[model samples]
Target: MTGRERHGTGARLRRMLAYAVLILFALVFLYPFVIQTATAFKTEPDAAAHPLSPIPDPVTTEAFAQVFGGTGFPLWVVNSLAVTLLITAGRVFLDSLAGYALARLPFRGRGAITAMVLAVMAVPGVVLLIPKFLVLNQLGLYDTYTALVLPLIVDAAGVFIMRQFFLSVPPSLEEAARMDGAGVFRTYWSVILPMARPALITLTILSFQSSWNEFPHTVVAVQDPALYTLPRGIANLVAGSLGAGTQYPLKLAAALLATIPVAIIFIVFQRYFVRGAAEGASKE
Candidate 1:
């Protein structure tokens, strides 16, 4: 074969290899969900008999019915929604504001503040469990919605994400706003915020996912059934609520329900994720 023919053949082979690898990885990542889904639809007997199988022998909705009917699942859903919404909103707003200040606002101790935030991020969250609990106790907020929502209102990582994004943003835009007599908050609210769609989306997704799946913080913050979020509730279910029984179908159904919101969020914002990434690259 000529050199051009040889090059074309090699490129096609490489493309095929890459596609094969991606498909393999997709299966590996998706297999669990497939199994979970099939198991959720499975009879308790079928689920127990074929634990790893991704096909249900006898599809049933009993597990789902039980999740809503037998447990405090609906209450758990409400608690999760309330806590997740509060935390997500708080983090997005507080973190973005802090990031803008760090990036644009000139002030003494800014470097120290940035370092402290970075330090907070570096420290393991587990180490703060006791301190957080103690503080909650002192504030008389334990086992309350305040306890669940207050502590997570600010996140260091979200701040860092926003900071980096703000730094990448063209300062000329802010400068123009200033020249037009816009105050700091006004500039941020009108000009900067509109331009930060990608970073905001990233922060939103991260905050939602983290807060939705939040277990550790909730465990430390509250034990009241009325305040129990999905993760905490599910943990109890696995620990003993089934009375030494392993109900794989019920467990999978609950998990599947818990996972759906985040999945939908990702699907809806997927294009924005890509667009945001591309914009970030160009901005940087």
Candidate 2:
């Protein structure tokens, strides 16, 4: 073969190999989800007998029916929705403002505050559980929705993400806004924030995912069964809330249903999420 033809043939083979590897990884990642889905529709006997099977021999909706009818899953959904929405909104707004200040605003203690944020990020969150519980208890906020939502309103990682993004923006934009008689907040709201859509979307996705699947914080925040979120409820279900024998189908159904909202949101905003993450990475 000619040199060019040989090179082209090698490139095609490499491309084919790359695709084969990616497809293999995709299947590996998706296999568990496939099992969860099929098991959700399987009879208890089928699920237990064929735990890893991707096909349900005799399909059923009994597990789904029981998830809603025989458990606190509905209340868990409501609580999770309320808490996750509030936390996501709060983080987006608060993190953006804090990031802008750290990036652009010249204020006393700004450097120190940024350092503190970094330090907090380095600290393990599990270590804060006791302090969180004590403060919530001391303030009489424990076991309430307020306890669940308030402490998580702001996160160091979100602030850091927003800061990195804001730093990447050209200062000339803010300068132009200021020359047009815009104050700091006005400049931020009208100019900076609009340009920060990518980072905002990234933060939104992370915040939503984190708060939606949160279990540790919930353990310290609330103990009331009436106030349990999906993760806590799922944990309870796994620990045998259904009582008697193992209800694999019911447990998998609850988990499957719980995973849907985050999956749908991620799929819908996937493009924006990717753009945001790319921008954030390129910034610093």
Q: What tens-digit string does per-residue lDDT give for candidate 2 at 146-242?
A: 9999999999999999999999889899889888999999999989999999899999999999999999999999999999999999999999976
Q: Cα RMSD (Å) per model?
A: 1.8, 1.3
Report clash pairs, candidate 1: none
> Residue 29 error for model 1, in Å?
1.0
lDDT of 1 by residue, 130-209 (tens): 99999999999999999999999999988887887888878899899999999999999999988888889988988999
TM-score of each: 0.94, 0.96
Cα lDDT, all candidates = 0.91, 0.95
Q: Could you say which candidate leads in lDDT?
A: 2
**Local error of candidate 1 at residue 190 (angstroms):** 1.8
